[model samples]
Target: MEVAVRVLPEGLEPIASIFEDLGTGGVLIEDPTLIARYKDEPGDTQVVSALISGQGDLPVVKGYLPVDERLPERLDNLKLLLDNLFLEQRPEISTSELPETNWATAWQAYYKPVAVGEKLVVKPSWEDYCSEDGRVVIELDPGMAFGSGTHATTTLCMQLLERHLKGGEVVIDVGTGSGILAAAAAKLGASKVMAVDNDPVAVRVARENMVLNNIQEVVKVFEGNLLQVVTGLADLIVANIIADVIINLTKDVPRVLVPGGKFIASGIIKDREKDVQRALKETGFTVLEVKREGEWAAIVSILGE
Candidate 1:
């Protein structure tokens, strides 16, 4: 059987995280307008589906959804939470039994190799791709940790990381979803990398990914919120989280960073760019660069002595 939720495009990332927490690693993303006839059509609705099965009389439900009367209640709670977070759209969730087939590999068709910045190439673990002479390839199975290296927020961060990294520096990746940035820093020749996330599952997936890339020795993954668990001083710190989180992190930026250290902060909506920039400046950071793609913005800053 398959459980599906039709959510707003803005909710795609968080919805996937919810599915991951449910232990369903794979999600099939369906866009109604991205077809042969409506290739250029713009649509707001996106469907995220997860596959499930029952072994016998006892049913298996993923994540926090139990196999009892509370299922509907839990789903309703989830919907309410999402509505509050997204604020602009309501999730229309639906469930249906699917015909027995290869549900595991079906979602793989939608994933492909994505090249970010000048040196980074993010390839799904199942996909095969040859790296160019100067490219660093990261094999990933994100497991719904909110990053696939294709999102504009992530791309902007990677681009900034590539440009700012000068090798042999200590790097800190806050809210390290899937540990993409940490692994990239390790591969880019950072002497040490710390990847931290509040989600335990994301931390686990990130550790696995680091091992998959054979960079585990250089990158360490931990489960924590923001910079609370971070130790030592970082020469470079990169955070690809939301604007509010970024604003809050500014309070401790000077404590965790070295003199003249670089801070790469992304995942800000364009409307909130000025707010975040102001916070960074107030917290003793000088804004260096501002890059925008679509409605997202990534800012790079330097800590002042």
Candidate 2:
């Protein structure tokens, strides 16, 4: 089953994250800027190419799910999630039976190389990128999960990581989707890292990305909820999850983070920034900085000011 949503380009990832949460096997983004760039003949790929062609400049986010007996229920849940996406009006949701081969065909056309922070460049494993000017490139194939580092939420967190991490600090990545942040922490010089995600599919994809980056030994990917599987204290904790989850995560952050350790909370929708800030402040964290990019914000704080 292929699920498609027409969304504003800036708001793409939030909707993508919902499909991810529902255990999508893969996501194929349709960026409107390249209508002329990709043209499929009227055939197997016609569904995808047609999807890409229309809509003028509006981008379409697509996710793949197995056409199983459980698909109807999953679709219902996905629709529910989409309906609550904090938008002024509900966006359109469309679905169809997609061929497995079309997944790669669409991915190649839209998933281009993206650079995050000063030196952290996220390139797809199939894409080629030359590392220069002190760039630290993390090769990844974020199948099904949302942490591709292209989204503003993930980008803000990566940029914050570059600024805050000095070296050799213990780190924790909550909701470690695709393990991108954990890979960033290791590449940025964390000594040891704990990467946890509640979703089994995300955990598997993250571990694969770790191996792709060859940081598996440095960053451990495990299946666990926000902080349940966390054992030891960490010098820094980065979470690129939503505002409600981030707000709920505040109570346990200080417990697992070392004294004065940095906490980077992202995946926050702009409207809920103050709500999250108040939650963090109530939990005794002093907000050090907040970085905003295209309708998303990341809050950087410490255990103790």
Candidate 3:
């Protein structure tokens, strides 16, 4: 079965991330007002919908936002969050059952090849994408993890990676969803890459993607939180996790980076950029640059030699 989730525009990004993490095949976004509004204008209302199958996926799915009787309470809590923020009007949250079909092939239509930076292209495994000369392609089957290259946060990380990588650097990717960053690093000429995720499902999915991209020899996927399982120092570390997790990871990042190593951190809301920057600064990191896309921000920091 599938659950169709509807929330206002402001709530779409986070909610979509949540669904993606939950292992849903894909989330379809619909905004009816986009056509009428100007190109830069954002639609006020939007729907974020996802498909989940069987009793196995139901328990895990309901833990976040239930499709059962407790759904009203979930909706109420979400509205309360919006109310406390006082940014915009509260979003309307609703859910309904969707007809089941062959989800694998059905979802392929929703994802396409996305170009990141100057050299890298993120293509779904089912899509046939012929890269231009001098471009590197990373094929992915994100499944439930994140990093399909569509999210602004992921794109910002990829852009920073493209700009900073000088070939033959050792790289670590914390909270490496879909192993996209790890695979990209390997394809971009990183000598060694380590991809870490606490979730077992994500670890498996990431490993599969590494093989799909033909970077298995250079990139290794591990199941662990942040840098807990990481050993040797890396020349570059990239993370596309939430702002709060980035703050926590900052404490450990310095210990795992070589002198003059760089960090590319994203998945931050524009409002929380300072909070993340402050954490990095307190940990003796020099904030090199801050990049923004819409309401999201990515920060590049370096450890002193």
Candidate 4:
């Protein structure tokens, strides 16, 4: 069932927190006037719009829970559990309609081969990219998923993988948006590569891309949150999610990594690099190298002894 709760004026935060606590999916919109107000008071309670299923006759509670009900306490505990399940913010673009100008072809027009590192070249499935002597070429189709090798985050992670991944190693790619990293690992001769994501749409897209690259057999795709569905230690673990998620995954990540195994992380803006590094250190990971490009940062760390 879908239920929508719109908090007017300055209520986005509280409303968001409420839905987040309830484990209900929703959207938050900012009108022009509120956008201006947001600049002045960014912390103003969030305006939330929630979508609930209509079949269920669940009591619809609106507005903040009363202080005396002890409901807020329950919601707070739920929020703590959900903090690891949901993305902090929804995507900026949520529309269902695609532009009619044939974005697939248009995007393809601008798409070109990307050189990830000295030995690897990431090429669009439609284009032919000649690999230099001893270099490997990874062909991919961006599709609806996020990574396509153009973004600095993906490139940086690929570079890290190229340098760290030895042939026939087992690799796990958490939050494998487009399956690019998993596919690349297979191409680089990793015997077993598993790519997993919480989003079913991402999983579908990643599977399709895996087929496009003809590595579906080597790269298994699964749907689940983080390491919950992934078992056993890996020779390498790559997580190219945002800083917050990386921080959250620190403890679980080390448990899934072989002793002295490497963890490569990206999708971190430069500003949050230190926070991620600190989280890794606290979780028993030693930072081995950090690479920065413009405002983005990627870290290569090892599981501590």
Can you write out model 3's per-residue Cα lDDT over 1-305, one digit (the tens) per residue? 34444545666666566556555545766554533244344533332111211212111122133356765665565456545544354444445554434543576688998888888888889888887666788899998787888999988988898889999999999999899888888887899999999999899999999888788999999998889999999999999999999999999998999979999999999999999999999998999999999999999999972
lDDT of 4 by residue, 1-305 (tens): 22233233334555556555565445344344424444445453333211222212222223223224555565555445434434444212111323455544577788898877787777888887666676787778767788888889998988888889879899999999889899888988899999999999899989998888888999999999999999877999999999999999988987789889999989999999999999999988899999989999999999975
Q: Can you tell me which runs of candidate 3 are displaced by over 4 Å?
A: 1-105
lDDT (Cα atoms) of all candidates against the true structure: 0.81, 0.88, 0.79, 0.76
Clashes of each: 1, 0, 0, 17
Maximum-TM-score candidate: 2
Q: Candidate 4, which segments miss by more than 4 Å at Cα?
A: 1-105, 132-134
| CA displacement after TM-score superposition, residue 242 of candidate 1 (Å) | 0.4
Name the candidate, 1 or 4, with the larger TM-score value.
1
Error of 3 at 289 (Å): 0.9
Query: What does candidate 2's lDDT look like per residue over 164-241, in tens digits?
Result: 999999999999989999999999999999999999989999999999999989999989889988998999999999
- Any idea how many clashes model 1 has? 1
**C-alpha lDDT (0 to 100) for residue 197 of candidate 3:** 93
State which candidate, 2 or 3, has the greater TM-score. 2
Q: Pick out the ten consecutive residues of candidate 3 with the lowest summed lDDT.
A: 50-59
The TM-score values for the models, in the order shown, are: 0.71, 0.72, 0.69, 0.66
lDDT per residue for candidate 1 within 169-267, as digits (tens), equals 999999998888888888888999999999998999999999999998899998888999988999999999999999999899789899899999999
Scored by lDDT, the top model is 2
- Return the number of clashes found in candidate 4: 17
